[model samples]
Target: MAVRDPAIDHLLELLAPLGAATARRMFGGWGVYLDGEIVVLFARGVAYAKTDALTRADFAAAGSAPFVFESRGRTVETSYWSLPEAALDSSEALRPWAQLALAAARRKPVARKARSGEDRRG
Candidate 1:
């Protein structure tokens, strides 16, 4: 088993009411998975939840911003949004928001593979 981040562990505990949530370290951060889907992430003591176009307005209205990172000298914005400051303090407050995040995560399109002999060699 990989070493777990204590901060991530505590965060997961608070989110327990949401359902079976598991955290795994990835690229110096943590990925929070629920129901076999990644719904949240923990990094630098902040929790970022998944968001799609349909759900981004909620975060925006709450004054939350999408996760941004600099890669190769360019800023990259992701679909994940930081949880509201109030929600970070209480699991009860975060429940609804987490649900919306999970719903948005499920909305992402799944990758499909090409069928056998269906692709051109060009």
Candidate 2:
């Protein structure tokens, strides 16, 4: 069963101008997608954006921290950071940040192993 949250739906509406944003239940919250790219996630009433080297500085400049959690007796930080304060209310304010996140998502390389049916000889 997929869990749903009204706040996530509201957030998607707020981000609509950027593109068609959709949400899916994931990790006890929701993963927000824009043009099929996962740019944001919501959990515990807070929102986080996917971050990479290209976008990390912007979040740091905004004083936002990467999502961290305790696991296996250690602290683990994810590649996602909280949305900049300026983005919380206005879609205009969030456009750039969402663009950056989308860029980062595009840059993230996908891992795919070679299929046995494929010929490897070159």
Candidate 3:
């Protein structure tokens, strides 16, 4: 099994009392799950929250940018934005942004198909 990132643990600690949050390995990086949905990623020493109006505003104020990855000579974006140190430092600063991200992420997730080949649309 792959190891969980420290940044993820810190983020999870900060986002408690809102929902179930944890880190799962995906595509050689860390994915932050809230209420069983992926809401962010801890990749390359950066804490990225889900892309949304509130989170984006906080991200901008913190002077953080989005997660831009280079792959196959092209730039790719995830449903994530950079996290600022102030947000991390302030006790309640990260919660609002986190909650918003979680709300958005809870809208999308993967579930197993039924054994009888019927789709369980969620």
Candidate 4:
């Protein structure tokens, strides 16, 4: 079952503009898609985007930690990024970053390993 939170609902409303593209409810939150590709995960009221070195710098400049999925004494960064604090203060500011992520999602998703019966061992 999915847990409910007011903050997450508000975020979903904020992201509803792209709802027709692709989005699924899982892990107690929503997975946002752009052009049928998942670029951001809306969870716990934060936006986690498709990440890379350049994107990492962008988030740092905006002043926020990347949505980290694991931390065992070391900070492991994920594609997730909290909505910039400054952006959260201004509604206008949020759209640009969200657009950036959507653009990333529009790219072709990288295919990993075997598709089906092609592999039996790693």
The C-alpha TM-scores of every prediction are 0.86, 0.86, 0.73, 0.63
Error of 2 at 73 (Å): 1.5
lDDT of 3 by residue, 56-120 (tens): 66667768788888999999976688876766765398877777677766654557557886777
Which window of 10 residues has the lowest lDDT sum in candidate 3?
A: 104-113
Off by over 4 Å in 4: 1-3, 18-23, 71-75, 89-91, 112-122
Q: Mind giving the per-residue lDDT tens digits that candidate 1 earns over 44-83?
A: 7778999999999999999988888899999999999999
Write model 4 residue lDDT over 8-101, tens digit each, in one string: 4555556556454446787767776655667667776676766554466777777867776555788676667766765544436656776767
lDDT (0-100) at residue 16 of candidate 4?
Answer: 59
With a 3 Å backbone cut-off (N, CA, C), the pairs that clash in candidate 3 are none
Clash pairs for candidate 2:
none
